[model samples]
Target: MMSKIISENKVAQVAKLIDKAKNIVIVCHIAPDGDAIGSSLGMYHFLNALDKMTTVVIPDAMPDNLLFLKGTKEILNYSKYPEFAGELIEKADLIFCLDFNALKRLGEKMEVAIASSKARKVMVDHHLDPEGFCDVTISHPEISSTSELVFRLICRMGMFDLFETDSATAIYTGMMTDTGNFTYNSNKSDMYFIIEELIKKGIDKDEIYTKVFNTNTVDKIRLNGYAVSEKLEVFPKHKAAMITLTREELNRYHYRKGDSEGLVNVPLGIENIVFSAFFREEKDFIKVSLRSRGSFPANKVASEHFNGGGHLNAAGGEFYGTMEEIKERFVKILPLYNQYL
Candidate 1:
C-alpha cells in the first residue's frame, strides 16, 4: 500500500462537498496540457460514477493528440463557448479546480467568470505557492503531476472503487507527459505503486504512451526539425542552450498548437548541457519554457525573469517582448547563473 499523502480532514471536506452538490463543474488552466485534461476528465469520470451532474470546462483548446482520451467530446472549451461555459460555472454547486494553482490561470476572460462563481471550490494541483482562493486546496509540489494528486484525493476519500479504466488511462497519460515519459521529477516509489494500481484497472499503458508521444503530424515533425537545426543556440561556458521561433517562422511550417511541446527538453539530451530554454513567439508575448539538470534551478530562472514558476528542473513563464529581445535578455542573464553549472 502507498503511504497516505493526503490529510484525512481535507478528504472529509471534499467528500462532504461532493455528497451535497447537485451541479458540479471542473476547470483547468489555459492551453491545457495532458495533466490538465487528464485530471479534469479523471474527476469527471468519478463524479459520473456517483451519479453527480458534472461538466468539464477548459479556458482554451487542448492538443489534438489528447483527443484520444475517453471524454474529449464532452469537454467544453471556454474560448469557443464562453457563454455556455460561464453558465455552467455559475450554476455549479461545487467546482473542482484541477491542475492549476491560481484563478488567473483560467485566462483573463474565464478568470472573471470563475472569480464570480458562488460555487464552493476545491483545488487539486501539484504546483507551488498556491493562491488562497479555493475552499480546499490540495497542492503538493513534490508530486510529479496534478493527476497524481487527483488520484491520491480519490483514494484518500475511499472512492478508489469508482476509479475505472478510462480514469486510469487519463491520469497515467498526464503523469507520463508531465514527467517527459518518466525522465525527470519521477523518483517517488509511490508513483510506481499508483501506476501499478492504474494497470490493474486494465488500461493499456504502452498504447497510451504511443498515442500521446508517437503520433505526430508531418508539419509538427518539420517544425521541430527546423527549430532544433536552425534556431538552437548553445553556450559552452554556461552549459546552457536556447531555441527561439518567431510567429513568421512557425507559420511558414504550418505550426499547430502542440507542435513545439517537447522542444525545451531537447537540449538537455546533449552532452554537458544542463540548462535549456525554448521561446516561441505568440501574438502579444513569447512563451517561455526552461529546463535544467541537477541543482541548476530552472524554476528560479522562470520566476525571476519570466513572471512564472514551476518545479526546480522544469518551469515556464510568459514575456511580452520580441523574440530578439527575449533571446538577448536570456544571453545577458546567463553569466549570473554560470556558477550553478
Candidate 2:
C-alpha cells in the first residue's frame, strides 16, 4: 500500500490537471482488454458530462463482450481515422492516458502522435512502476483496476452523479474482469464500494457478467479446444505452460471475435504450474500474455523483460519476431524461474 499523503497528493495533482483542460483525448494500450475499454469509456462519459470536448481513440477494435459499453460504438478507430485522430490529438488541451502506464504500449503509430502533441499528458492507471512521462501521473500498482481509480477521482471531485448507468455498467465491467471478478491479488475494500455504487446506479451485474464471460460462440469453443490440444505445451516439472497459435491456425479453427481472451488462464489451473503464458502470432507481431497462480509476479517478468506491465498475476507484452523466435525466447527464459519458484 502507498502512503496516504503520497496517494492524496497524486490524486490532487491529477484533478488539477483535468480541471484545467477543456479538450481531452483518451487512449489505452494496444490489443486492449476489458479494463482498457471500460476505463477509457468511463472517463470519456464523465468528461462529456463536464461539457468538455473529448474523443476516445482505441488502438484496436474492442473485444466482443466489451462492445456493450456506452461509448463503444463511438470509439474512434485510430488506425482507420488517422487524419482526424491527428487533428484532435494535436489540438487537445490534455491527453488522458488511461489503463496503460507507458505510452509505448499505445503502439508505434500513436506513440509518435503523443510525443508530438502539445497537450499536457495526464496518466490515470493502476499498473506497475510507470515511465513518468506525464505531467501528472496517478498510478498505483496496488489498485484493483483503472476504473476503480477513475470512479474514486470522480467521487472526490463531487461528480459521482455525472456517471450515467451506462458509464457505471462499463466501468463495472472493466473492474470486474481486470480483477477476475475480485479473484486476483489486487482486490480491496474500495473495489466493492465502487461496485455497490454502480449497483445503486441500476447497473445489472448478472447480465454484464453473462455478456462478458458466459456468452461464447460455437467457433470460440472449438478454438479453445484447438488451442489446448494442439498449441499447449507444458514444461517438465510444470513450472510453465505455453500455447502458441498462428494466424493460419486461427483461420483454420474459424476463430471468432474475442477467441483469445483469457486463454492464458487455462494453464494456471494445472497443479504445480507456477507460471503460464500464451504466444499469439498475429499478422504483424507476437502478442504474449502471462499469468501466475501462486507467489510468482508475472507483471514484473513482463515489465522487466518483455516491455510490458499489468496486474501482478496478469500481464502482457508484444515482441517483434517469428513465432519460432518467440517460443525459443520464452523457453530460454524459463530457467530464470528458479529464483521465484
Candidate 3:
C-alpha cells in the first residue's frame, strides 16, 4: 500500500539534511522493539558514513536482547546521559526520530530535549496518521516495518552498498520481527523481494532467527510456562482471553526486562478467540497488550478504553491501577465487542 508519492525527493531531502548537519542525534520510542532499535542504528550508520557526529539516545535502558546490535553499546541511556544528550540535542543541526509517531512515546526523560531542540526534527515511521509534531514527516501505515523505510532511504541515496553486516542484520531482524516473521501484513511478493535483498547481503538468516526466537534461556522458558499456565484466562462465551503477570511472578521466575516479548500472541492461535489481552505489572503502572482476530479492531478498543492505539489487530495501553481494576474495565466493555463479533 506504499504509494509513489513517497518519491526520491522525499528520501533525498532527509539524506541532504543529514549530509549537511554538523551534530545529529537519533531517538526512538521508549520500550523499543527491533524496528525502533534497527531503524535508529541503521540511520546512525548512514549518517556516520558521511562523517557526521551522531549518537543514539534511548529514554529508557536498552533491552539485553538488543545488545548484540552493532552500535548498541553506543546507545546513551537516559539516566546516565540525560544532561549531556540534552545539551547535544539543543545544539544539534538535526534530529531523526524513528519508529514512533509521537514525541510522547519517547517518554519523560527525553521529552524536554525533543521540545527544546533548535534542530529541525524529521520523523520516519510506519504508523497511522501522525500528530504533526515534526518539521517533516514520512509516515506509511502500510509498510511492514520502519526498518524497511530505513533501507529505502539508503537505497534511494544510492548508498545501499554502504550498509555493513551489522546494520543489515539489524534492519533485516526488525523487518522479520515486526511482520510476525513475515506472516503478518506482508504480501508474499514484497516479503520475498525484501528477503532476497537481505540474503544477497550475505546475512545469516537462520542464525538471526535462532538468536531472536530460539536463544531463550532455561529461566526464560520457565517464566513463559508460568505466564502461560498460571496467568492465561479465557472467557469462552465472550471469545476473549487475558494473560496477567505480576512483578512477584517475574521475580520468582527470575524474569528480566525483555523476557516477555511474544507471550501475548500465544492465545491468538486458539480457535474462537476474537480478542486477546496481556497485562504485566511494571514498577509504576500496568502494561497492556491487546490483540483482535476476525473483524475485531483492537486499536479502537485500546484508544477508546485503554488510552492507546496501534495497528487494527494489535495495540497496547497503560493503566495506573491494580489488576482488579483493569479486569473490571475489560469485563464492562465486553458487550461492546459483541457488535464486532
Per-model root-mean-square deviation over C-alphas? 0.9, 2.5, 1.9
Residue 264 local lDDT, model 2: 89
The runs of at least 3 residues in candidate 1 whose Cα sits more than 4 Å from the true structure, single-residue gaps closed, are: none
Candidate number achieving the greatest TM-score relative to the actual structure: 1
Please provide TM-scores, in order, for all candidate models, with all chains considered together.
Answer: 0.98, 0.92, 0.95
Better of 1 and 2 by TM-score: 1
Candidate 3, residue 195: Cα displacement in angstroms equals: 1.9
Q: Candidate 2: where is the Cα deviation over 4 Å? A: 1-6, 236-238, 303-309
Candidates sorted on lDDT, descending: 1, 3, 2
What is the C-alpha local distance difference test score of each model?
A: 0.93, 0.82, 0.83
lDDT of 1 by residue, 240-313 (tens): 99999999999998999999999889999999999999999999899999999999999999989998888899
Model with the higher lDDT, candidate 1 or 2: 1
Q: Write the per-residue lDDT of candidate 2 for residues 212-297, one digit (tens) a residue.
A: 99888888888888899888999955488999999899898787657988788888788888799998887778887899976788
lDDT of 1: 0.93
Tens digit per residue, CA lDDT, model 3, 1-341 = 22343567777788788778899989898988988998898888777777889999888887777677789988887767788878878888899889999878888768877977789888989887687878778888878789888887777777878877777888888898887788677774665676678788778888877777887878889998988888888988789999988889889888887888888888887899879999989898899898887678888888898878898887898888998899898888887888888
Clashing pairs in 3: none
Each candidate: how many clashes?
0, 0, 0
